[model samples]
Structure formats: C-alpha cells, structure tokens
Target: MISRDCLQQSSLMAYKNVYQLLGVAFIVGLASGRALKADEDASPRIGIIGGGIGGTSTAFFLRQLYGPKLTIDVFEAQKVGGRTSLIRVNGEDYEAGGTIIHKKNIIYEFQDKGMAFTTTEDMLRAMGDDLLNMTRHTMNESLQHIGLSQRFIDEFAAAAVKDNYGQTLNAHGFLGVVSLMAVEPDLWAIQDGNKRMAELLLRESKANLIKGSVNTVALIKDNLGTGSVSYELDYTKATPGSDKETSESREYDIVVVAAPLNEGSKNKISFADFPRDVVTFKQDYHKLISMFVQGKVNTTAFDVGSQNELPAEIISIAPGCFFNSLKKMTPVSPNSKPDTPLKPEEAVWRVFFNKDPTEEEINNLFVSHSDLRLVDWWAYPEYQAGADLPPFMLYDRLYYVNAVEAAASAMETALIGGRNVALLAYNQWHGHFDKIDEVQLPSPAENEETKKSEL
Candidate 1:
C-alpha cells in the first residue's frame, strides 16, 4: 500500500513538473500553429486578463488539469495584484488595495482543513429560502429572520458590512451580509506585503505572464460554421504612470476576464458583441477610495487612550462619518531597510471611503506628504436586493471570474471563482463536463466539512 507521505511527495513533484511543462508547452504550441480548428486536436491556448488573485488562480488550477503541457498566458496592465497592492510611506509598506485575508477564503484551504465542521444544513435554516435563489434581500431583512437585536444589528453587524463591502446593511443584499459573516476570526497577510501573494501565485502557475492592458476581447469564429470558438485580445503596453508601448493582438482558445467588469475603472477591458446582461453588469459598479496616511492619530477621536486599547483591528463609521473605516497596521521594524527614511512619530494607517474626503476632514484625522497615498478604485459591485449576477461562463469558452464579486468582493471569492472557471474550462476541454454549469469550488473553511461529516 502507498504511504500518505509518499502520496503527498508524489503530488508535490507532479505539481512542480506540471508548472515546468506548462511553460514549455506554451512555447511549443505557439510554434506548432495551435489555432482555431474544429478537430485539429492540439494543446489549447488560454488567455487570462488581469493578474489578480482570480486570473493567477485560474492559471494555477488550469496547470493542474492540463498538466505541464498546457499553454496559458496571463496579462496584467500594471502588476500581478490587481487591487492587492503595496504603498510605501515613511520607510514603511502598507496595503493600498486588498488588505486583510480571511481564513475562510478559498486561498487558505490547507489551514482550514482542521476547522470544526458543519454539515450542509437546510438552506432555509442557514440563510433563509429567499437568499437561496437569485432573489435578493437587504441585510436588515435577513438579520431580522435570525432574530438579532436592533442595536446589535445597527452597531456591530451593519458596521462590519459597511466597512468590509463599502455599503451599508440597508444598501447591500443578503449575500453581502453572508460574505461579511464568513470572515474568519484570524486574518492573514504576507509580512512584506499582501500583494506578494499574487506574485507567488503567478510564479507557481508557470504561465506566460505578459505585462499589458487589454483593450478589447472579440470572439472570432470560422466562416464555414465550425463549432469551435476562439478569442482575439487587443492590448497595449501603456499602463497608468508608465511609458506607452505599441498595441498588439493575440488569439487564444479560451479567455478569462479576471478583473472587475467596471466600465469606469482604469483597467476596464471592453468586450465586442458581448451579451446585454454582461454589458449591464460591467456598467454597474461601486465606488471606493483607499487612502494611506502616515501621521499620528487622535485616539481621542476613537474614544480610546492608546491605539492598543482599540476595540477592534478596524474602526468603521456609519453613514455620517467622513471615512468608511480606519485600519491600524503593523509598524515597520527598526531592522527593516526601506528606501526612504522614516520620521520618529509618523504612524501608518489605511483609510477607506466612499467619496474623497475634504481637506478639513483629512486634516481632522491625520495632521499632515503624510496624507498623500490615494487610490480611486471602482472596487466591487454595488449588489442591490433582487439584482441578478451573471454566470462565470459569459460566453462559450469565455469565463468571467469577477461575476462572483456581486455576491462578495473578497480575495477568497476571487480565487474560488477563478478555480470554478478553470474547472469548467478543463471539463469542456477534456469532455468531462457533467458539472459544467455548477459552482463546486469549496471555500477554505468548508474543506473539512465533508470529511468530518463522513466520520
């Protein structure tokens, strides 16, 4: 009988070989003219737009399915971490986009393997029957079903929903509230930066990582009515705050849009002749601004004597507050060598807002370059009650990972959504698509549920 250690070692080695083969297969497939043919039978050419957790995880999971011989390409306008970015101030680094990662997210599957398991209870009992379907309900209405107090609902649950999703409980849907409740007790991040996780995912995938902004994606078909579908991606190397490069085009058997489908975003990519539903989803987006400041905070404003005595890691505000939330970050160690020198009293804090704060409002919180880092991100979808979210398969052979953002905008959701798409793509490619239209990717905490139930 095979030992557990041997099985684990073999799996690790298999994954390593898969990555190495994916790189080699991509180059070879390009040279061998692996184009859109109905029955040519060759390695598929996969294209992933947006180098965030969704896109990188798509590539990673694809490698596992197609092995080392899969041809995959990942395109990023700026860096790998779409919203998960890093900013340096006063010789310290802070997350500019995605800050905290929940252990229940799909990314931390290994750690969640030991969690206390819960079986699949009745959907009505867990989240109510109304939330089970696409029919949406506000968080207030849903929490009422659970018999929560008005004060607890207003202060704690509502505050967390607003801060985490950039929308109040009254404005968000039932799924949005579930997403907030899904946050694990322990949040995790890389020591240097949270964006490093995206970088690591890309490296593990062994995909042909290209740096460019995708302008348009068009579905190309054979004039003779062949059933095969191919995609043409037109992109340019011109990124914000970078020198512009010439526009280029490429063809792939499959295309996955990993970034948020917001028309107003800087990294927004247009789809030619896309479904009307997809267009509508792309246009509807939420507005969020992430600001990083280096200065002393008025603990008096927080009704606390010192930062250590804060009630939580974050201080979220209701509708009237100037900023959505203020998160205290770990300070840079003295041993750390940053390119810039630090001021003795400057502390790094990250603030989130639905709109830009006024000069007076900014000064009220942070005294002083100390308040410079600003990012106008379209963030996620403003999921309203009864609003419909499109499927991952936007079109044939074209997957949309950010569609899940309408329900939850966590990094775990992105990774899980991407993995589901990857599985779909793999199933179609190998003709094992029994569960083609299903979302089967388990979240980090759910991995142990099935096993514990069997016991």
Candidate 2:
C-alpha cells in the first residue's frame, strides 16, 4: 500500500514511459515506410548550410531518424563552430564566444521521441497564457509584476543582462530569464572548448563537409519531368595556394539554412526563383568584442587594498562603465591545473565590451599586461520586446534553424532549434502530421489506467 503522494509520482512516471513508447512506435513506422521523393534504391539527399552547432546537431538528429542510408552534406564558410570559438592568450586558450551551459538545458534528451515539431503559433499555445504574456513585456516590467524588489532588478538582474548580452534590463522578458539562468550555480562548459561539441556532432553524423560559401539557393522544378522539386545551391570555394576561387552548384531533395538571415549577416545567401521573398522583415545582429588580457589587476582602481581583496568576477551596474564584465578565466584544457588559491595579480582576464576599449581604458583596468587578444563577433539578435517570432519553416521542404534566436540565443537553444528543424523536416516529408504542433499531454490518471490495462 503506497502513500497517495507515492502513487501520484508512480503514475507520472508511467505516463512519461507511455509517451516514450509511442514515440518509439512512430519512429518504427517511419522506418518501414518508403523514402520520400527518393528513388526506390536511393535515400533522400539533405543539404545543410553553416557548420555551427545548429547545422551540425541537425545533421546528427537527421542521421538518428533516417538511419545510415541517408546522404547529408554540411556547408561551412569559415570555422565549423561559427560563434563558438576560442582565443589564445599567453599560450593558453579561453572561450571567446559561447561560454557556459545550464543544467536545465535539454541537449542530452534530444533523441527523445516525445519531442514536438512546432511553429510559432504552436509554441505560443504550448507555453500557455502566463508564459506567453511574459514575452509581450520588458524584463523589468515582467520581473516587477512577479513581486521582485526594484533594487534586485536594477542591480543583479541588470548585471546579468549586461554581462551576458551586453544589454540593459529593457530586453525581452523571455531572454532576460535566460540571462539570469546563465548565472545559476549548475552552469558548466565543455572541457577543451565548446566548439568541440560542433566538431564531434559533424563527425558522428557522418556528413560530407563542403568547405565553401553558399551564395545563392534557387528552386528547381520538375527535373526530367519527374514532377519532383529540388534546391540548387551555388557556392564559391577558394583554390589552394592561389588567389582564386571556383564556383560550383549542387542539387538536394531538402535544404536547411542554419545561419541567421538578418540584414547585417555576412553570409549573403540570396533566394532565387522563389514565388515570394524568403525573408521579408529586416533583423539586425548585435556586435560584441571579447578582449583577453594577461596581466595584474589594478586593485586600487577597484577600491580594493590588495589583489586578494579583488573579486574573481566583476559585473557592472553603472552605465558609464567601460566594460560589461571582467572575469578571471581558467584554461580551456581540463588536464591543466592552475596554482592553488589563484593570484589575481597574475592571471588571464576576459573583458567583454559592446565596443572596442581605448588604450587608456585598458591601462586603467590593468596595472600592466604582457599579452592581449580581441575577438569581434556578431553574436546574437538585437532582441526587442513584443516582437513576433520568426517561423521555422521557410517554405515547403526548406527550414531555418536560427529562427529560434528571436526568443533567446544560447548553445542549448541552438541545439534545440536544430533538433526541432530536423524533426519538422522528417515529419513533413513522411506526412507525419500527428507529430507536428501537438500541444496536449495525457493526464496522470489516464496514463495510470492505460498502464494497468497494458499489464
């Protein structure tokens, strides 16, 4: 005779197990079905643009869903990890881009069958009224409505947003919650660097990596009068040991654009022969500069008596501050060990700035420095409160992974978006309409009854 609380918990577990089994059944059904738009002997051809976390993770999920026979091609213009990169200072590397991962991030559960492939409307409905209303207000207003004191919002909350996004508390409430999560104690990062995740995902997916910049994507209609449509990608690759580039084109049954389609984007991929514009409204990206310096701290400047009195991390609430945050960093390599009780006087510090710091500003922060490196990045979107989120599905058989960035931008969110697009593409191709935009879950009592019936 279990207690009522224990029985309820058991029922919840049964419900989750039942949902997982249903998802497994759905996958088995897809496996038994014929491949969509492919010759009976061949598998579907998938082309993904950008080799960032979003693109690489999408390839990984597609491989898991479609099995080994599927052909996946990943195109990257620069480094594979995109914004997740590293910078070296004094012979040691530090995270220059995406730094931390929260404990609540669902990257490990990406293969779960209960996942839903959803659109913007579906996402709003799934969030329910309370969470949906938060998106319509600024972070300050949202937090205030939740009964938080104004001082906490102005100091700690503002500092979190400033340190994470280089923005103030006026950002969207949804992303503000994300920013606050970054400061949680459960946060951790990859051992060597976060970029390694992207590299490993690409390698595990067994995708052919195409090293080139895609310039244009055009719709190809009825090749050989088969009444089947495909996409043609025009790209340019640099010739080795020469100041020249070669142009090439390839066709694929499905295409995924993993990069941001913003007006300020460097990857100018134009859409050709489409009935309408692929992306109409203009979105701008925010610029962030990560400066790494190896030097002693100016204890006096921070109103501290000595190096031991200085904080390991400093977050600024003052608007006139030159930098957003300054932090003492550890080596990217997990094997390497630092001296016990780190000396702030002799350490590597990472300083984040919305703009480049002047020489005077650098001198004021540090008494002296031996080495310095700076990395400029078009990190994330310029988030606005009450802005409409972009659609994941751009057109038939075409998807955009970065559309999720409008709500929040992080390594975990990027992987989630990638998985969502992969599922969306697979479901749409195989006519699995039942799996898309599903907003309801069965009650615990119903699941318990079903569990007993099955037994």
Candidate 3:
C-alpha cells in the first residue's frame, strides 16, 4: 500500500539488518573458534630425558595414566636401552649390559593381573614397602645383620654384584641388597637382547622418541596468563632421514630426567632454577671393562680332570687376578664332543674386569685372539650407602626417576621408579598426592601362575 520509494527504503533497511546479524554471528564464531584453539594449545606436554629403561617406562606409564590425548617426547643421546644394551658376536647377540629382570616386580603385576599365589602373606610381608625406604642401612650392614659372614659375602654376593653391575655390596644401600633378592631361581631374559624391551616400551607408549642429547632444561612461566609454570627442554636432533642435525627447543608441562646425572657425563644436562638439593644430589659411577673373546677355558689352568667337570657357568678369579669373572658363553650341546676343538665363532667367552685388561692379558686368556669380538668400558653408577637421594618430584611438575639409583639400580627398580614418577605426576595433575607412592605388586607364585596361564 506504501509508495515505491518507501518500499525500497524498507527493503534496504531489512537487507542492512540481515547483514548486521550475519556480521555478529561471524564475530562470535571466530572468537569461539580461537578460544577452542587456545584450549587445545594448552594441552599438557611431557618430556623425558634418556631413553633407557627408566625413560621408556616413564613414557609408557604416562600414556597409561594420561591416556592417548597427551603428547610425550623421549630424548636419547645414544641407543634406546642405554646401559641395558646388547652386543653381536659371531652371529649371536649377547646381552652385554644390564641383563637382570626380576619376575617378582610390579611390571609383571600390572601386565598380568588376577593370578593365584601360594602364601601371598609371606610374599607381601617380605616385600615390606619399608625395604624401599631402608636408606639408613648399607648393603654390608644389612648382610651382616642377616648373619652372612664377610668372607661369604665377598666370595659370592659381592662377586655377583660386582661382576654383573660393576658395584660391590659395600657401595650399595639396603634397598640395593633387597633388590638382589628380587632374583628368581628361573631368571629369564630375551634370547635376542634386552634392548628389545626398550623398543617395546616406546612402541606401546606411542611417544615421539627423539634421537638426541638433551642439553638443558629451563623453567619458564606459562604465557597463557594462568599463573602456571612449565619446563623448556633444549636438545640437538640427529635422528635418521637427514644427515644434518638441528638444535630444537620445546615447552613441556612436565619433565622427567631418567638418566643418571653424573657431573663427568658426556651428556650432562643443566637444570635451570631446579632445587639446590636435587641439583646437588650425590652422583658417582664405577669403572667396569667388559670383553668378549672366543676361546675355551684352560682346563689345566683350573686343574680340572675333564672340561665337563670344569665350572663352565662362572670362573671366579682370585682377588688380584687380571679379570673379575669369566663366563663361558658356548653352552654344551648334547651331541657336542668333549675332545673336539671349537671353531673361533663357535666358542665365545665373556669376561668382566674391574679395570681395563692389557692386550697381553687378553692374549693370555684365549688360545688365539683371532676371534676376539668386542671390548667395552662402562662408567656405571653405584648406589651409595648413605647417599641423600632426591625425591620423585623435584618441583611441582618436574619429576625424577634416576634418584632411586642412589637407593638401588636394577631393571625392576628402574621400572618401579618410572611407574612411581608417572603416578606422582598423574596425581599431581589430578590433585591426588595421597596416591603418590601407591604400589601393588604380585607374588612370585602369582607371577608363575600368570606365566602358565599365558602359555
């Protein structure tokens, strides 16, 4: 009913109103999208230094605790297994590093749950979580209290730890002595190598395993204005694909130092603004030399009537001998002839020495040095008797797993440390510090039952 001009004006006003509404909706949608992006960016990131048993286990446990939503990065300078590595000699891969894996541990507990056990009370009573905190007693003191004479300890227990871990019982704490008890009569190891376990952990974790040396870890305040702080990890990447490695830095909500922090280490990491106690924790290493030579033991040297009667398992040398322990690696087959001489590759011998053996000493052991395969020097750490080991958490979000090394350094302990830190970190995130030190381990018999069921 209105005029054409009025009609046109009304249409224009409607069109202008519609355009204004569209502009407001676009602005709101853009703001909401940015807010969502900011929330996504705030997702927590975890960084683990050292890809050994501790580091890999930390990554795996963190994933289990935090679910697949969180991102974890594990940085390793050398191989993934670190000291728990392997060596190849004459087509056979030998576990040249930490080879002990106890069955009576929590890793197996969680891996295989709800298994039966004989006298769970005895197993649990012996565990006595108190053993983990028994830092007041030295290994020697504990053994003495248990009525083990010094001579027996030196000959057997001390020799076992020294030859295997490069540390004497005197240098270890009560926790380390208890860890030695974690061994089973039917101790098992992966035939290929123990390094495969590290590989498995990384694969299971779905973590980004970066091949690099972490140089520094710096604490920084979060830019999200939430009054929160985070850790900045700086490292150099030299992984596969590109020949040229580049320096990279990343911000993490949490950081875990899994490797031993020896001052003289080649890959020492500087922690900026970390606690003085944690920064000044006792860190020391033992000198160990391992050699793999191909030869048979001189049966006459030990005065054995027959090579069969010779102690092929282990030959413990006297106190002043050139080597600590010599293990015969070539197992006697049923069809093997006792009189037949073994070929160079067929006969493998492993020797552990407290000090570096001279070439002449090596030549003296083997009938021929033509098949000598690998020789390695390791600066392994010893659990100090009364060392004031650091806590699992250095700061609010910064955790440590290697601090347990001062109490004990075993594959099981490493796994436990990794799990403990993961639990502590998860609890810290969820405001549940009460669950920090919680643990549930299976008995040896339960573990046996689990193994049988799996089989």
Candidate 4:
C-alpha cells in the first residue's frame, strides 16, 4: 500500500506541474488558428446562463482573459447565489445551503496568476493517479484501501459524508474525500454568507445581470457568408408588475451554461441545430432538505441527562434516524454576538435530512421552537462509482461548467469548473490548442534542467 505522505506529495507535484504549464501558456500567448473572426472595431459578446458561483466565476475569468472590451451577460431567474443562499430564522439570517469551506480549497488561491487556464479533465488529471482513482470506487472501498481503520470509516468518515452530502459511505470516493476535507482545521466561511462570493464575483466581472431564465440556445449560421458562427439565446423575464413574462432573444459570440443540464435541473435550455445532443447521459441530482429551527434540545430523546450533556452537533449513524445530522448555527453577520453557553432553548439549529421530518420527529429532536424554515435543494449530482464524467465543452463556442459536479460537488469545485470552462472558451477562441486537454506536464526537475540549459 502507498503511504499517505507519498500520495499527498504526488498530488502536490502534479498540481504544480499543471499550474506551471498554464503560467507558460499565458505568458507566451500562443495561437495556432483563430475560431472567432477578429474585428478590431467590435468586441466579442458573451452570454452566461445562471448567476451562481460557477457562472459568476466564469464571467470573472473571462474578463481576466478577454479583458474589459468584451460584453458579458449573466442570466438568473431567482437569486444571484443559486445553491449558496440564506434563510431567515427568528429574525436573523443563517446559511441554508453551502457552509464551511476547506482550507486547502483552490478558492483561497484566487490571486495566483494564470491559475484558470486549463480544462476540467486536465485539472483532474493533474491531481495524480492515486486521487483520480478514487473516482472509480465507493468511499468505503477507497478509504479501506488507503489503510483507514474500519472504525474510523464507520464513525468519523460516515459522519462527514452524512453531514456534508446527506449520503452514506456508498457515495463515490472522490466526493467522500471532498467531504472529509470539510472537517479539516482552519475551515472558514464568509462573514455574512457564502453567497457573497457569487455577488462579488459578478460585480467584479462587470457583467450585466439579466433577470430571466434562458429557455433555448440555438446555433445561428452565418448567413452573411462570413463563415463565423454565433449562438442565439431565448429567455423570458418577468414583467414589472402584472403576471406576465416578456420573451426576448439575443445573439452572442460565445455561451456558457453554468448550471447543470441534468434530468431534475430547473434550467431546461434546449439545444437546436446542433450536430448531436449536447449532453447524452441521463444525470440526476440528489434532493436534500435543510431545516432551520430556533428551539431547545430534547435531551431526553438523545438519552442525555441534561441539555448541557448534548453536544452542539449531532451525527447519527442509525439507519432508523430520519435526519442526517443536526448542527447549531451562528448568525450570518459576524458583528452579532451569540449568547455564551448557548441556552439550549435560544439556539438556532440546522438539520439536514433526505426527506422532510414529521411533526413528531421534529418534536422528538427539539423541545420547543419559535421559528422554523425549510429550504429544499436539488443539492448535487447523484454520484455513482465508476460513472463517466461529463465534458467541459458542449458544442463549439458553447461550454458547461457544472460538468465537474460529476466527480465532486462543492463551492470550490464549482469555481474550479467555472474557471475551466472560461479557459477552454478563451483557448478555443484564441486558437491556443496547446493548452487544451494537455495529457502531461514536465516535472519540476525537468523544468529546472531546461532553465539551466537555456541559461
């Protein structure tokens, strides 16, 4: 069996190699053939579907690559933060969706130059074979193979998956690793809410936030004999006052679908005049319910002597348990001071469940409550071991950001996916084929040798 340290070192080396190649690509500005017609007087127009982390981050990276001259439009029907959102409880806002972020997540490395110039496949390949092999097995098998004790896998590992994904050890190993990362030290979240990341990325990208849901993306042939192709998007925006939706259409040089194009997804943007189906697989998302209740702990139900005996968080492994986990929540605002010693009756708790809890079940979990709010989410992909991952490119000049969710779904992964799609688009537009789908990168030692040779 390979040592854990060896595996970590290998993954780190792989990441370094990939990033180094990307830096070189950005510096050289290599071009083989241009996909979009170059017009000095006209800047390329881009349309992005969804206003979530993936979409917003794609816009941000596109701005970084294409500069401020490009026009970008982001379409969102309801809110800017898609799955990362908030809910009100007892007149205070609390996170209802994605919460903690791992310290090692790439989100913190946003300041690194040339970090986003790679495809999803290339990025995953750079993580080394050991970590990539995790995608081919169940979490149970992968952890056991990695020399983790069964006791730890059953208790700690199970709890992590249950709490983060609302799934058991049967989940794919890659996502299980992602779940375990959540428990790592130095994990943090935004002061107000995680959704602020999306809002701020959108603002920084300077993209127009269109209030509507995109319905169709059709390939528009160049009837003017310019041999250039564009995509037309048809969307519907709610009328100002009355109960009506105004339909509108627009054309763009490139389009990025930042949301999932799966069976249960709300976005139903169809592809027209394409050579083949955009996405051939029948993918589905897992349903998770986040229930927030401001209430007292039912100590007796937990077999505890008193409320103080109960921990702030509870992870249940029993198959009969209706909920995955229960955790005490803090206010969204960092300025608000939570009462010390947290009076059991005054605390706000978030309970994750695969299904809605019955009134009796709720009563059994909590003694009393003043406010209760529930947010149902098609949270993530129904991950299956050995399942084929989706592609970053859907069609020429058309990309999908949520394809990375097939391996693991998290805020950081969403951002990574967004950056990848943006890079793929940029590379294809600028004819930088050398940077796309690169199979291997030179080792650090090789890079140093080449530098010495050049000197």
Global lDDT of each model? 0.63, 0.75, 0.61, 0.74
Candidate 1 local lDDT, 1-455, one digit each (tens): 22233222111100011011122333233224321222334468999998998898778777755666778999998888888877776666666777565554332332112111011111111233345442366777777766777776766666676667777766544554554553534555555555656776677778998888899998776333333688899998765586757889999988888887776778678777543444544337778888877676655555457645643345353445556776655532324664555554455667788899887767666545354778888787777766655667777777887776666677777776776677667666666544333223466478688778889
lDDT by residue (319-342, candidate 4, tens digit) is 546777778777767455543434
| Prediction RMSDs, each to the true structure | 12.8, 10.9, 24.2, 9.1
Show pairs that collide, candidate 3: none
lDDT of 3 by residue, 168-263 (tens): 566644644654553324454543456666777777788998889999998776444342568899898885786888899999888899988877
TM-score of each: 0.76, 0.84, 0.74, 0.84
Model 1 alpha-carbon drift over 4 Å, by segment: 1-42, 105-135, 173-179, 182-184, 222-227, 238-244, 273-283, 299-316, 331-346, 368-371, 438-455
The reply for model 3, stretches above 4 Å from the true place, is 1-43, 106-134, 149-151, 173-184, 222-227, 239-244, 273-278, 305-307, 315-317, 330-346, 375-379, 437-455
Candidate 1 steric clashes: 2
What would the per-residue lDDT of candidate 2 be over residues 191-276, giving only the tens digit for each residue? Answer: 67788878877887889999999999899863544325699999999899998999999999889999998777777899999878
Question: What is the Å distance of residue 144 in model 4 from its true position?
Answer: 1.4
* Model 4 misplacement above 4 A: 1-42, 105-119, 222-228, 337-344, 442-455
| Candidates arranged by lDDT, highest first | 2, 4, 1, 3
